[model samples]
Target: MKIQNAIEAKLSEAFDVRILQVENESHKHGVPPNSETHFKVTLVSPDFEGQMKVRRHQSIYKVLAEELAGEVHALAMHLYTPAEWDAKGQAAPESPNCMGGSKKDPAMNAQGDH
Candidate 1:
């Protein structure tokens, strides 16, 4: 099975998930071609009903220990319980570009005038 599928399966078994979206975001990062090293996961599950954000993330990390150690280099997670997801209209906001020119470093552009 593919890495993303493996991750989804593991999470599904560990939680009573209502929604799950595992996106391969390696292409957006500054990595070698065909690198399946990074990902973003958006999951809404009943298991997270009364959990804090940190706890929710910890639970997911615990379930994905093997993938975290072996295949995945980086993971950006947006986890929510069904109620929380519904409160926000069940839509996840778009992620802004991280590696490209979207973020400008002041130190890098030391010359004040652009």
Candidate 2:
């Protein structure tokens, strides 16, 4: 099974999710082509209600421990409760590309010349 599908299955089993989108963002990173090491996830569930941001992230990390340790190198998560998602008009922001490391252009560097 694809990593995204696996993650979705796990989340669905663990939470009463109203919305879930698992995006394979490895292509936008500075990794080898077709790498599945990076992902962006937007999840809306009552399980997240009243939870702090760190707590929400921790919950997801705990659920995805194996994937984080093995297949996934990085994950950008946008987690919200159903009410929170409704208040925000149900629009999840897009994750920007990972522009760190030698892949970033020198001109965009804040420290000026390396």
Candidate 3:
């Protein structure tokens, strides 16, 4: 299964999911074309009602342990209970642009003049 679909399915099976969005953010990062190294996930579920944020994140990480250890380079998660989702107007924050090795450092840009 595609990584995004796999995440959705797993979370659905694991919880009473109200909303789930798995975004492949590889293109925003500096990975090769068609890479699935980075991701953003937003999950809303009743299972998260009494859980702490850390606990919620742990659950997801546990479910995706294999992918985390191997294929996935970064996993950005925004987990919420149904009420929290509603409070936030049902929107997850967008992922930031890549600033890893592939992104040029402004300080280093003047190197060519030296």
Highest lDDT, which number?
A: 2
lDDT tens per residue, model 3, 44-97 = 999998899999999999998888898788999999999999999999998878
Listing every candidate in turn, what is its Cα RMSD in Å to the true structure after a full C-alpha superposition?
A: 5.8, 4.8, 4.9
**Top TM-score model:** 3
Q: Which model, 2 or 3, shows the larger TM-score?
A: 3
Q: Which tens-of-lDDT digit does each residue in 13-43 have in candidate 2?
A: 8889899989898877666667778888999
- For residues 25-94, what per-residue lDDT tens digits would candidate 1 score against the true structure? 8767555567677889999988888788899999989999999999798888999988889999998877
How displaced is residue 106 in candidate 1, in Å?
17
Candidate 2: stretches off by over 4 Å:
105-114
lDDT of 3: 0.83
Model 1 clashing-pair count = 0
Model 2: residue 67 alpha-carbon error in angstroms: 0.3
Cα-based RMSD of candidate 1: 5.8
